[model samples]
Target: MAEIEHPKPFADWETRAYWEGCGRGEIVLQRCGACSKVQHRPRALCASCLSGDIEHFVASGRGQVYTFTVTLQNNAPGFREACPYVLAYVELEEGPRLLTNVVGCAPDAVSIGMPVVADFTAPDRDLAVPRFRPA
Candidate 1:
């Protein structure tokens, strides 16, 4: 099967650490120093308490398939060739639900609540995209 050609992800000040961590084969998330709430899609301020004291930490990379769907059709360049892929929201053990793909298995084999672990694509120009696979 042809791999989906993911577009290179660029990082801004808020997400620089996350992109860097992925490049290092680690999944990183943010925690609020004030509320101690963990979040993904890295941001400068804590979404819960609006605190600027957010800290980045390496996540365990373990999660479960919270929900998912198999995309049989996509007109977009990279995705079009990768039909029948599993698109899922993986609920990380750290509390963030990352919108990622579940690979390394048939789409029909994936299910809700299935255990999974982080898998990263080879760094393309210094950035690695995170995905998941059955644990």
Candidate 2:
């Protein structure tokens, strides 16, 4: 299989814990203390209740493929080499959906409602990215 070069992810004050958790081979999410809602794309406040009481925790890294597309063409640097890759929205067991690549299988083998587990890329880098594969 061809290796896909993953660019480094950016981290800010509000998202530092998330990036750090990824580096440790974990998926981090935030929960609102007020509304008891879980969310992704780490933020300083809750998107549901707009409350400042937010807490971070490691996620199960398991989910189902909500939707997906097989990319047979791309001219970008890293993606060009990774033609025929599967990009999908994985609905986490925790509630939020993440836009990520689904690897470790053929593109045609991926389908909606398929079970998957998180996989990390660039673990040696400052931040790792979460990809998904068949569980």
Candidate 3:
């Protein structure tokens, strides 16, 4: 069997800190310095305050499962080996939700409101993706 290559995530100037932090084992989230509202999806302006005073901060990396789906199949290239994985929306303790894979447990064992912590996968030197597992 051949090793499967993982998909690399995209990072732009507005969100560079996040991927960089992930490589360093930190979960980064952005906060609006103007109004103090924190958010994810790493945008230029705040969703609540609409201010451009955004700053990235390291997060606690603990969250509850807001939702999830068990992926029994993946047609995309390099993703077949990842079948039977748990894809989930984790609601962070810092008040943002991140779309991440829930690992370290059976797909059938995942549930909404389940406590989880961040894990990381570094496929290359330049990036790392955050995953989650039951806490």
Candidate 4:
């Protein structure tokens, strides 16, 4: 896990699988079994119907930039070296939007409505953070 350069994740029961799957290079999302709506930021109850039935599934990993900003400065520990990066809200193909960093290109090149796809970064051995990039 020497590839990881940031903080490790501390996942609780509700988010355990989501975080663990990322470490294995998979983008997993929770889909409400009751309402059939896919979601991120795992919840015990379905966001649509408030039902306590949810299951995990691999996401398509394809999305469009809804909005974004380039971080010119940050002191949040382990993020200093990643300054001037593109931070964005990506609207996935399945309808869930996630806040993520857009890498693999110039920070200024990112634009609203641009197509993006997932890229995993193992900031810690047991944690793989998902970042997006131009597609």
Which candidate has the top score in TM-score? Answer: 1
TM-score, one value per model:
0.96, 0.94, 0.90, 0.88
C-alpha lDDT of residue 67 in model 3: 98
How should the candidates be ordered by TM-score, best one leading?
1, 2, 3, 4
lDDT of 2 by residue, 10-113 (tens): 88999999988988989999999999999888999999889999999899999999999998887888888988788899999998999999999988999999
Quote model 3's TM-score.
Answer: 0.90
Give the Cα lDDT of each candidate.
0.92, 0.90, 0.85, 0.83
Local accuracy of candidate 3 as per-residue lDDT tens digits, 17-124:
888899888899998899998888888899997888998889999999999998778887776776767778999999888888888887899999999999888535
Give the residue spans of candidate 4 off by over 4 A.
Answer: 1-5
Ranking according to lDDT, highest score first: 1, 2, 3, 4
Tell me the lDDT of model 4 at 79: 72
Winner on lDDT between 1 and 4 is 1
Clashes of each: 0, 0, 0, 0
For candidate 4, lDDT tens digit of each residue in 1-135? 012146667899899888888888878899988888888889788988999989999888899999999887877666766677777999999888999888888888899999999988844667688889889
Give the Å shift of residue 70 in candidate 1. 0.7
Candidate 2 segments whose C-alpha is farther than 4 A from its true place: none
- Cand. 1 Cα-lDDT: 0.92
* lDDT preference between candidates 2 and 4, better one: 2
lDDT of 4 at 10: 81
The candidate with the higher lDDT, 2 or 3, is 2
